[model samples]
Target: MRIMLDIGHPKDVNVFKNVILSLQEMGHTVKIFVRAKESTKRMLDDAGFEYEVCPYYKSMAGKAFGILANDLRLYMIARKFKPDVFVSPGSPYSAHVSSLMRKPHLAFSDTEIAGLVTMLTLPFTDKIYTSTSFYLDLGPKQERFKGYYELAYLHPKYFKPNKSVLDKYGLEEGYILLRLSALSSHHDLHASGFDFETEDELRDYISSLEKYGRVIISSEKLDWDTIKEYQLDLDPDDLHDIINYASICLSEGATMASEAAVLGIPSIYVSNTERGYLNELETEYDLVYNIPDRGEALEKTISFLQNKNTKDEWQSKKVVMLNHNIDVCNFIIDRIINIDKRGL
Candidate 1:
C-alpha cells in the first residue's frame, strides 16, 4: 500500500515519524505532508523525515484558506504518488483532500478534539481513531479506540534517546519538570483554567516548591521573562528524557501528564480546564493525580509524594496497560490495510 501522511499540528510530528517507519517496515510506499505552521519545519528536520511543504498556515483562519490550497497540494501529490490511502490525525484540511480522491481516509485522533470539530469533519474522514477507552461518539462516522496519549511512535523502544540531550540541557539530579498549557486551541473552554493569569497565580506556588527542589518550566507558548527567570535549559526534541528522569512532573497539558504516567513518574495535572484525557487517565489508568483546580495542585503534589497507595496503585495499573497495550504502528497499519481491502 502507498500512504500519504499529513500532520496538521507541528507537535504531532513525532507521531508522524513513528507511523512513517511502521508503514515503511510494513512494505508500504509512504509520502509525507504537513502544515508549514510554527516550527513545523524543525519538527520534520528533528525527526530526519523529508517532505513536501504545503503552503498552508496552522492557525484556524489560515487553515480554512489552506483547505482549498491543501486540496490543490494533496491533489498534485496524489497524482504523482497515487497512494492507496490518505492518513492523518483527523485534520479538517486533510479530510477535504482525501474525500475528493475517493480513497480511504484514516485519521488517528486522541480524546482532545471538540465535539463541534469532530462533527464538522466526521462525514469526510473514513476512520477517526482515539487512544482513549471511552466511547468516541463524536458522530456516527467516527471510530474511537483504546490507546495512549504518548506519541508512542517516538517511544524509547523505537527511537533511542540520546544522552547528549541531557548533556545539552546540562540537567543534573534534583530538577522538577513542569509542563504548562491552556489547551485553548483544543476548544475546551470549560475544562481547566491554568492560563497565563492562572499560571501566574500558581507561579509563586511552584517557585515555593523550588526551595525544596529545582524547577524547569516547559511550554508551547511561554513569555521571555518566565524563561529567563526559570533559567531552563531544554532541548525541544527530547523532552521525554527530562520527564522520565524528573523527580516530579507538573502540567496543565493532558499529553505530557499521560507521558509521565506511562514512564512511571509521579504526575500532577492542573485540572482547571476541560477534563478530556486527564479524566480518562484518572478513571481508567491509575497513572496520575487530577487536581480539581489549581488551588489543589499543591496539596495533591504533596499527597502524591507522601502516599504509598498512589504509587502502588499506579504500579499495578502500569502492568495492566502493558498487557492491554498494542504496537500502535502495527495496529494502525493493520487497520488501514483491512480498510483498503474493503475498498472504503
Candidate 2:
C-alpha cells in the first residue's frame, strides 16, 4: 500500500516518524509532505526521509491564502502520488485534499480546544483519533485511544533517553528548561503565552530562576540579544533528552509541558488557554501546573523546586500514567495497516 503523510509542525514529525518507518519496513511505500516549521525539515532530513516542501507564510494576513495555496499544491501532489491513504496530526489541508482526491484521511489529534482546526478538518476526514481524556465531542468519526499523540514517540518502547545530551551540551549540574513559544498560530488567535510587561520583567523572571540552577531559554519568537548566552541551540531530538534530565521544565507550550510530564519531569505551563491533556497531567497525575500569568508561575516554580521530593513524587505519578496508557506507536502502526478493520 502507498501512504501519504503530512507533517505540519516539529511535533507532528515526532508523532508520525515511527509509523512512517514501520510502514516502510513492512513493504509499504510512504510519501511525506512537510511544512517549514521550526526544525521540522531538519528533523525529517536527519531521519533520512525524502519529502516535498509545502510552502508556508509567516504573517497572519497571508495565512488563509497560504492554506488555500498549500491545499491546492497538496491536491496536485496527491493526484501524482496516487496514495491509498492520507494521514496527519489534524491538518485541514490534508483532510480537504484527501477528501477531494477520494482517499481515506485519518487525522490524529489531542487538542480538543482547537475548535477552528477541528471544525474545518472533521467533516472531510474519514477518521479522527484522539486520547480517551479528550474533552470535546468529535461526533461519530472520533476514535478514542488510551494514550496521547506524544506517547507515540515519547513512550519507552519507541524512545530511549540519550544521557550523552548532558555531556554534549556541557550541562553537568542541575538546570531548568524554559520555553517561550510564539503563540501566533491560527488556533492561538486569542491566546496569550508567557507575556511580560517589559524587558525588565522578563529579565527579572529569568533571574528568579537562577536560584534553582542554570536557566536555558528556548524561544520561538524572542530574539534574546541581551541573554544570547542562555539561549539553547540544540537539535529538536536532543531537546527531549535534556528534558528527561532537567531539574524542572517551564513552558508556554502545552505540548512541551505534557512531554515533560510524560517523562517524569515537573512542568509549569503558562498559557491562557487550557488543554485537556494538561488538565489530566495536572489533576490526575499531579505532574504539571498550569499558570496563566508570570507572577503565579514563578510562585509555583519556587514552591515546586523547594520541595526536595518533587522528582520522586513526579516519578511515581508517571508510573501510574504509563500503567494506564497504551503503546501509542504500536496502536498507530496497526491502525494504518488494518484501517479497514476500523470500518473506515
Candidate 3:
C-alpha cells in the first residue's frame, strides 16, 4: 500500500521513524511531507529520510495563510504520489489534504487541550487515536490506546541508551538536564511557562541544582547568563542519550517531560497546562512531578533530588507500566495495515 506520513515536529519524526521503516520493509511506498520548523528537517536529513519541506510562518496571519497554502501543496503532492492513506500527529493540514484527495486520514494526539487543531482536523479525520488517559471526547471517531504516543518509538524494545554519549559530551555524573522551550506555538498562546520575570527565582532554581550537581541548560529562546558555561550544544538525536544518563530532568515542555518519564528518569515538569499523559505518568507511574509554577517546581525538584532512592523507585514503576501497556509500534502497524487491507 502507498502511505503518506506528515511530519509536523521533531517529536512527530521520532514517533514515526520506526513505523516508516517497518512499513517500508513490508513493501509499502511511503512519502514523507515535513514542516521546516526548528530542527525537524535537520533530524530528517540526519536520518537519511527523503522528504519535502513545508514552509512555516511566524505571524498569526502568515500562519493562517500558510495553512491554506500548505493544504493545497499537500493535496497536489498526494495527488501525484497517489497514496492510499494519510497519517500525521494531529495535523489539520493532513486532515484537509486527505479530505480533498478522498483518502483515509488517521491522526494521533495525546494533548487534550489542542482545541484549534482538534476542532479543525477531527471532523475530517477518519480515525483519531489517543492515549487512554486523554481527558477529551471526540465522539465515536476516537480510539483509546493503553500506552502513550511516545511509546510508539521510545519503548524499551526500540530504544537503547548510548552511554558513550556521556564520554563524547564530557558530561559529569549527576548533571541535571534542563530544557526551556520557546512556548510560542499556536497552542501555547495564553499558556504560562517558566516564570522568568523574577530573575532571582530562576537563579535560585539553578543555584539549588548546582549544589547537587552540574546544571546543563538547553534553552530554545534565551540563554542563562549565570549558567552560560553549561549550555547544551549537540546533535538533536543525541539528546535522548544525554537524557537517559542525566540524574534528573526539568522542562517547560510536555514532550520532554513525558520522554524523561518513559526513560525512567525523574522529571519535574513546570507549566500551567495539564496533560493527561503527564498526569498518568505522575499518578500511576510516579516518574514525573507536574507543578503549576516555578515555586512549586523548585520545591518538587528539591524533594525529588533529595530522595536517595529516586532512580530505583522510578525504574521499578517503569517496569510495571511497561508490563501493562501494549507495544505501541506493533499496534500502529497492525491498525494501519488492517485499515488499508480492509478498506475501513
Candidate 4:
C-alpha cells in the first residue's frame, strides 16, 4: 500500500511519525507532505524521513488564497505518487486533492474550534477520526478513538525519557517548563494566553517562578532580551524528554500541555479557549489543570510547585490514564490496514 500523509504543524509530525515508520516496516511505501512551519521540516530531517515541503502562507490573507495554490501543488504530487490513501490532521489541501484524485482521505482531528478548516475538509474527506472526548459531532463519517494524538508517540510503548537530554541542556530535574504560543493560527485569532501588559511584566512573572526551581521558557514568538536568559535553545526532538522530567508545565499551547500531561507531568494550560481532551484530562483524570485566566493559572502553578507530592500524585494518575487509553500508534496502523483492505 502507498500511504500519503500530510503534516500541517510540528505536532502533526509527532502524531504521525510512529505510524509512518510502522507502515514502512510492514513493507508499505509512505510519502509525507509537510507545510513549511517552525521546526516542522527540521524535526522530519532529524528523524531521517524523506518528505516534500509544501508551500505555506504566513499572512491570513495569503492562507485564504493559498488554499487553491496548495491544492494545486498537492494535486501535482498526488498525480505522480498515486497513493492508495491520504491521511492528515484535517488538512483541506489533502482533502481536496485526494477527492480530486478519487482517493480516500482520512482525517484524524481533535480541534473542534477550527471551524474554517473543519468546514473545508470534512465535506470532502471520506472518514474523520477523533478522540472520544472530542466535543463536536461531524455526522456519520466521524469515528471515536480511546486515545489522543499525543499518545501516538509519547506512549510508553513508543517513547522513553532519556536523562542524557537533561545533561545536554545543562538542565536539572524539577525545572518549570513554560511554553508560549504564537497565537497566530486561524483558530487562535480570538484566543489569548499569559496576559501580561508589558514585556517587563512578563519577565517579572517568569522571575517569580524561579523560587520554585529553574524556569525554562520555550516560546514561539517572544524573544525580547529581558527573557533571553530563560529562553530554551534545544532541538525540537528533545522537547518531550525535557517535558518528561519537568516538575510542572505551564503552557499556552494545547499540544504541549497535553503532551506533558500524558508524560505524567502536571500541566497548567492557560488559554481563553478549551479543548475536550484537556477538559477530560482535568475532570476525569485530574492530570491537567485548565485555567483560562492568567492570574488563576499563576496561582495554580505556584500551588502545584509548592506541593512536594504533586509529581507522585500525577504519576499515579498517569498510570490510570495509560491503562484506560489504547496505544494510539498501533490503533492508527491497524485502522489504516483495515481501511485499505475494506477500501473505505
Candidate 5:
C-alpha cells in the first residue's frame, strides 16, 4: 500500500513518526509532506525521515491565499506519488487534493474550536477521527477513538523517561518546566494565555517559580533579554524526556500540557480556550489543572508544588488513564491497513 501523510503542525511529526516506521516495516511505501512551520523540519530531520517541505503562510491574508496555493502544490505531489490514501491531522490541503485525485482522505482532529479548518477540510474528507472526549459531533463520517494523539508516540510502550537528559542539561529531578507559546496559530486568533502586562512582569513571575525549584522556560517567540537566562536550550527531540522528569508542567500550549499529563506529571494549562482532552485530564483523571484565569492557575501550580504526594498521586491517575485508552500508534497502523484491505 502507498500511503501519503501530511504534517501541518510540529506536533504532527511526533504523532505520525511511529506510524510511519511501523508501516514501512510492514513493507508499505510511505511518503511524508510537511509544511515549513517552526521545528517541523528540524524534528523530521532528527528522526531521519525523508520528507518534502510544502509552502506555508504566516499572515492572515497569506493564509487565505495559501489555501489555493498549497492545494495546488499538494495536488501536484499527489499526482506524482499516486497514493492509496491521504492522512493528516485535519489538513485541508490533503483533504482537497485527495478528493480531486479520487482517493480517500482520513483526518484525525482533536481541536473542536478550529472552526475554519474544520469547515474547509471535513467536507472533502472521507473520514474524520477524533478523541472520544471531543465535544462536537461531525455527523456520520466522524469516528471517535479511545485515546489521544499524544498516545501515538508518548505511550509507555513506546516512550521511556531518560534521567540522563536531566544531567545533560544540569537540571535537578524536581525542576519546573514552563512552556510559553506564541499562540499565533489560526485557531488561536481569539485565544489568550498568561495575562502578563509586559515582559518584565512575565520575567518577575518566572523568577518567583525558582523559589520552589529551578525553572526552565521554553518560549516560541520570546525575545526578551530579561528571561534569556531561563530559556531552555535543548534539542526538540529531548523535550519529552525533560517533561517526563519535571516536578510540574506550566504550559500555555494544550499539546505540551496533555503530554505532561500522560507522562504522569502534574500540568497547569493557562489558556482561555479549552480542549476536550485537557478537560478530561483535569476533571476525570485529576492529572491536569485547566484554569483559564492566570491567578487561579498560579494558585493551583503553587499548591501542587507544595504538596509532597502530588507526583505519586498523578502517577496513580495516569495508570487509570492508560487502562482506559488504547495504544494509539498501533490503533492507527491497524486502522490504516484495514482501510486499505477493505478499500474504504
Candidate 6:
C-alpha cells in the first residue's frame, strides 16, 4: 500500500513522525507532504523520512483563503504522490482534495472535530482515528478511539531518540526543564498572549524555580538575541529527556505538559484556556495542574516541585496505563489491509 501523510507545522511533524515510520515499517510505502517551518525539512531529511513540499504558506492565522490554498496544495500533492491512501494527522487540506479523489483518505486526529482543520477535513476522511470518542461532533463516521495519544500511533517503543545529545548542551544532572509554547496556532490569542509578555516575568519565575533545581529553557522558537538575553539554553534531544528526568516540567504549551505527565515528571501547565485533554488528565490523573497566570503558575509549580504525591500517584497509574495500552498501529495497519476502500 502507498500512503501520503500531510503535516503542516513543526509540532505536527513531531506528532506524526512516528506514525509515518510505523506505517512504512508495516510494509506500506509512505511519502510525507508538509509545509516546512524553520529546520523542519532538514530534520525530516536527517531522519531519512521522504517528503515533498506543499505550496501553501502558513501565515493567514486560520483565514479562509489559507485553508483553501492548503486544499489546493493537498490536491497537488495527491496528484504528484499518487498514493493508494492519504493520511494526515490533522491537515485540513486532505478534506477538500481527497473528497474529489478516488482513493481512500484517513486522518488521525486528537483535536476536536469542530476544530478548524478537522471541520474542514471531516468531509473527506474515510476514517477518523482519535484518542477518545469525545470527537463525535464530526458525526458517526467510521472511527477508532484509543486510551492515549502516545498509544494512538506513536509510543516510546517505536520512538528512537538519542538522549546523549544533551551532553552537547551542557545538560548535567539536576536541571529543571521549561518548555515554552504559545496558543497562537490554535487561534486563541488570549490564551497564547503569555508568549508576547516580557521575559522579566519568565526570568523572575525561573529565578524562583531554580532554587528547587537548575533551570534550562527549551524554546520552540529560538531567537538567539532574546534567548541569550534571557539566558535560556536550547538542547533539542535532551530537552525531552530532561523532561523525562527532571525534578519538574513546566510549560505554557499543552503538548509538552501532557508529554511531561506521560514521562512521569510532575507537570505545571500555565494556560488561560481550561479546556483540552490536559484538563481531562489533570482531573483523572494527579500529575498535571493548571495555573491561569504566571504568578499562580509559579506557586503551583513550586508546590509541585516540593511534593511527590502527584508523581507517585501517576507512577501507580502509569503501570495501569501501560497495561491498558492498545497498540493502535496494529489496528490501523489491519484496517488498511482489510478495509474496503470503495466506500470510505
Indicate which candidate wins on lDDT: 4
Structure candidate 5, residue pairs in collision = none
Q: Which residue pairs clash within candidate 1?
A: 131-147, 191-273, 191-274, 192-272, 192-273, 192-274, 193-272, 193-273
- Best first by lDDT, ranked: 4, 5, 2, 3, 1, 6
Give RMSD (Å) of candidate 2 vs. truth. 1.3
Q: In candidate 3, what are the lDDT values of residues 198-317, reduced to their tens digit?
A: 656678778887888888987776555644556767789898888888888999999999998998899888889989989988898788989878777777887878889988988898
Whose lDDT is higher: candidate 1's or candidate 6's? 1
Task: Give the runs in model 5 whose Cα sits over 4 Å from its true position.
Answer: 340-343
lDDT of 1 by residue, 266-329 (tens): 7888765434556666676667778757667777676665654655566577667656766666
TM-score of each: 0.86, 0.97, 0.96, 0.98, 0.98, 0.85
User: What is the number of backbone collisions in each predicted candidate, taken in the order shown?
Assistant: 8, 0, 0, 0, 0, 0
TM-score: model 6 vs. ground truth:
0.85
Q: Which wins on lDDT, candidate 4 or candidate 6?
A: 4
The CA lDDT of each predicted structure is 0.68, 0.85, 0.85, 0.90, 0.89, 0.64
155-198 per-residue lDDT for model 5 (tens digits): 98899888898888888898998888988788998999996779
- Better model by TM-score: candidate 3 vs candidate 6: 3
Regions of model 4 farther than 4 Å from truth: 341-343
List ranges where model 3 is wrong by over 4 Å. Answer: 198-201, 223-228, 341-343
Model 6: weakest 10-residue lDDT segment is 230-239
After superposing candidate 6, which stretches have Cα over 4 Å from the reference? 55-58, 61-63, 133-136, 142-144, 152-154, 159-163, 193-196, 221-226, 229-238, 308-313, 341-343
Tens-digit lDDT string for candidate 4 (250-328): 9999999999999999999999899999999998899999988877888899999999899999999999999999988
